[model samples]
Target: MTRTEMEARVRELLVDLAPEFEADAIDPDEDLRQQLDIDSMDLHQLATSLFEVYGVDIPESERADLVTLRAIVDWLDAHVSR
Candidate 1:
């Protein structure tokens, strides 16, 4: 899928994960933690959900690399086969 498609998918995942956040307010370029006030546990849970949904594993060591929406998209883009 294209980057734009990946971004949209990521957004969809985030929306499903955090129903408290207004979908339209999520900034694709902003830090997810800061924008959404998500805690570490919430982040871990979200990552796990993403992996389950996409069938892609994200190592714990690299979890910090996914600090923003763009970062998650980039990680998936790099790890997922075309």
Candidate 2:
């Protein structure tokens, strides 16, 4: 998928998981756990939800790379793209 599409999907996954936050307000550079009120469990849930949404299996070892929205986008672009 293209980078724009990947970014959009990441935002969509976040909104789907947590509707309280303004999807548009999410700073791609900001850490979701620290900035978005998402906890560690939320991160795990987010990862699982993202895998379900994108049909891609993000390895457990790479979970550390998903700390921020930008990171998630980069991870998906690198790992999920065909």
Candidate 3:
């Protein structure tokens, strides 16, 4: 997928987990957990959902690497096979 597509997917995932967060207000550079009020459990669910939806593996160790929406989209772009 293109970078734009990846970004949209990540935002969609964030919106799924945090419905209270307005999609338009999401800051790509902001820490998703802090900005969206997503707890560890929510993040865990996100990881699982990503794997299920995208077939991308996000090991527990690398969870820290996906801090923001932009980071997650970029990471997935690099990790996922074309």
Top-lDDT structure, candidate number: 3
Ranking by lDDT: 3, 1, 2
For model 3, the run of ten residues with the poorest summed lDDT: 1-10
CA error at residue 78 for candidate 1, angstroms: 0.8
Least well predicted 10-residue stretch by lDDT in candidate 2: 73-82
Tens-digit lDDT track of model 1 for 1-82: 8988888877777877788876667887888888888888888788787778678889989988788898898898888877
TM-score of every candidate: 0.83, 0.84, 0.91
Candidate 3 clash pair list? none
**Stretches of candidate 2 exceeding 4 Å from the true structure:** none
Better of 2 and 3 by TM-score: 3
Candidate with more favorable, higher lDDT: 1 or 2: 1
Ranking by TM-score: 3, 2, 1
lDDT of 3 by residue, 20-46 (tens): 887778999999878998999899888
Stretches of candidate 3 off by over 4 Å are none
Taking the tens digit of each residue's C-alpha lDDT, what string does model 2 give over 1-82?
6899888877877876779887788999987877778877777778788778777787889787678899888877877757
The per-residue C-alpha lDDT of model 1 at residue 18 equals 80
Cα misplacement distance, residue 66 of candidate 1 (Å):
1.0
The all-Cα superposition gives candidate 3 an RMSD in Å to the true structure of 1.0
